[model samples]
Target: MGSMSPIRGCRRTIMMSSVLLFFVGGMSATDGAPPTWTFVTGGRIVGSPVVTETGRVYAVAEDRYLYAVEHGVARWRYDLRVRPIGPIRVSPDGTVVVRTRADSLVAVNPGGGTVWAYRHRTEIASFEHGGDGHVLIGDSAGVITALSATGRVVFRVAVGDSPVTTILRGSGYNLFAATRDGRLAAITDGGARVFRRLFEARIEAMASTADRVIIALSDGRLIAVDTFGREVWTIGVPEAARRLGVAGAHIALISDNAVWFFDNSGITVGDDRFDGLGDTVIAGDGVFVAAGNAVYSVRASQPRAPVARFSSGVGAIGAGGGRVAIGTDDWVLSSFGNAHATSRPGIGARVPYWRTSYDYLFLKDQISAGTDQAVRATREMISRVDRADLAGSYHTIRELLIEVATPRTPRTGRVIPPDVRSAAVRALGRLGDAVVRDFLARAVAAETDPLVMVAIFDAFTDTGIVSPEPILEIAARYLSRARGAELSGEIARAGVDLVIAAHRYAGYVPDVGVELLRRAMEAPFPREIREYALTAARQIDGR
Candidate 1:
């Protein structure tokens, strides 16, 4: 093993042990062989590579080119003229199918010729290949369309309002479609709706076993339903599952911190923890996990270990044709045989877990104290805390801030000191999470202190909220209240801040906050408020 060069901005690295050569549960240590073949792509790979049964690999890159490689050599390249979306797939007839950013699906023949192309009127959300050589596509309009191998529409059905995120083919001509809003619909092959089930959270990923369809929710719940759409079982984890893969009767749920395996009845089989996050695919009897810069092949009976490591971060991974294909962030694609291989010994990295720091407890205590100096110190500490630690501390900090900012004696008209409240609001704003947007909106509506109002408006802006309709509507109502009345100095200052915050969404949602900005421009408000409002409105109008 060679000494590793220092990785820029990396805090820690794990050194592989030399004496570790034991085989566990029929899985042996890698023989440390090099990759069978390596190919460099024109750009970073967008999704996982697809390997056909004939050892041909298909990969798409950001450069808008679909590459074909066999045995480490470039076979042919086709220009799609637009970046492809999602992973490239092959139909039963050996035609390559790829969806593009232009809302079209292009199928290429074995000789790299365009066989046919199908364009959708709406954005293609998800797609899957059916058993009868048909392409099942789900669009943003909640319509599922099945196209024959010749690019003809076989049938179309409207599932629901939310965009479909996944499509799976079940047993005996049964099909399943899951939407973004947590609605799973089971449809027959002839477009007849069988049943539909709705969950409480967003559907993140889905996979199917022999007799059950596994659904993963954004709230960290896994559900299994039978062919008749009846709930079979459910389980919970700490983090949401990003991807799901099925190997025989075992299901693998890949989350940020770990890979959990469950049996046919939702019983825990085995699990492995690793740092960083990546994609996974189940091939043969093993689950290939791409994490950080390495791809680890984990058998159901063995602990996780890296089979291949790369110099750069892995972008995507795929397994087929008795080999594993990996795409790296450095614009390279490589293939290796099923046997365990390693580029070199004693080379691995793990991100340090910083959640164990004691500073979070100290900051929480100081913020809860609610003194002016304590709040100030807490604010400084919040800014210094790493963003990774925010997940662990966000709820604690938010609750403390809400408690300190709320008035304890509303009946007597006595409130928490405005300065302390304002500081806490500013700290909440610095959290940069939109989950607190509703709380900030409610505080702005109920608070009477103008200084705190200004802080709340600024915090709302700092949340980086993509959906600003609710807050914008509130601003319009507030502006309407001050239309003909004399605006106090502090009130005018807060109004100006609100206008400035509303300006950030000018072109993205031109119509959302236009009424609020117009109201700001017409009020008995100060000249600064009117100027900001006028500028914002013009930007929205593209003047």
Candidate 2:
């Protein structure tokens, strides 16, 4: 069975800073729980929750209703009459539109009154709003249509020979679409074609900024194209991208089990693995991912670690204007810390969590469970750490050290011991603070096993520890002994690790590694150590 204990931002500049502080400081201060306000709905939410500028929340449910929620109470609800065919969208001018499986587009006013309806001949496969109060629709019959603000048909034309799978609004009144047969087409608002391009692989996902449109293919290729359909740059990923989205210059691509972030120049900025990721959004300086029953927020400017997490059966998420909101399979709509219209003054009663916190449970299991127990946990906790919440953070760090720094597995009968040590060190680095750094440095000194020492050095590098004088002193002693007679390859390997760590942590090799590497290359040190040191020196020098 899938692990039952499952797992799983916005703002302008000031909004971004507030969000960072909320998660960075709020988690440990509030007993490791981030504050959340949830509004219960009548049925399962089928679409993403939309939060307006004034903090009103709108969401669609499988029960054929669209709800307008103000604070924790329903302001009004309109019967959608049929299941929503697409996500409920609020236009720039505050017109709410939802497409039904009946192949009709329904527009509603902000006060829950019906505005207009446009009926289509075939089932609508995709739809998007043209920013200037125009609706773009694509149907399974290979037709593309544009409707004005009043539901008047602006243009209707056949674009391809297969179903239109994607539709998006570009600069001004231009519309872009992709077909099932690997065709991409762009047209102006007046029905004039700009360009069309065909590819060998089917387009799996498409996202655009103001100037470029990015498409991810089934063959694990991502291509950025201009408005004229000219290729700008392409990147070959390890796996086919299942979903794609753009947040500023950062492009987020979700493959089978990992999330990859790339800049417009095609250089990778962030990459990490998370299981069961369902949706992703980039707002402010962070990337928000929805997985299982949780929404995880990872900062883009800093380390690729989850800084904040909100627990719910998150089906879809949306964030903008300094507010973050989510819709869940449990029919609950939630918002985190924003002022808005509310019938009540304070928040509702806290919703008790089945598992208090995933990270907390993982740490507890690591410390309390026997090595033989098949305990499940999450590798979360990637954010800035400080002294304000040092108690819990240090306690968890100690548990990690017990699990990882131990000489052997707790159980002798174990056949394949868990590799929790490396994970533990990585967690320590993700924690990223003076306490963590000091603990790791002490662990490196006390550790006798060569293999564990290697892991400790790697962790030190990840935690931004450069110019480690004490570790270097120990490494020089071991290197000298290996040169004498013992020939300890592991010790030499640790020296090489420190060399690389210096380069990565502080952007340059320290004097210790450089001097030792040069000496090893000249004389009777073992051939393996000489070769490794030479390679490390070259890498450091190149950087």
What RMSD does each model have against the real structure? 20.1, 25.5
Q: Which ten contiguous residues of candidate 2 have the minimum total lDDT?
A: 1-10
- Per-residue lDDT of model 1, residues 191-286, tens digit only: 545556788999898887766688888887888987657789998877788888676457788887777888878888888888876877777656
Indicate the residue-level lDDT of 256 in model 2. Answer: 62
Alpha-carbon runs more than 4 Å astray in model 2:
1-38, 304-312, 337-543
Candidate 1 least-lDDT 10 residues: 14-23
lDDT of 2: 0.61
**Residue lDDT tens for model 2, 252-273:** 7777677788887778988877
Question: What overall lDDT, based on C-alpha atoms, would model 1 receive against the true structure?
Answer: 0.65
Q: Cα lDDT of all candidates, in order?
A: 0.65, 0.61
**Which pairs clash in the backbone of model 1?**
none
Best by lDDT: 1
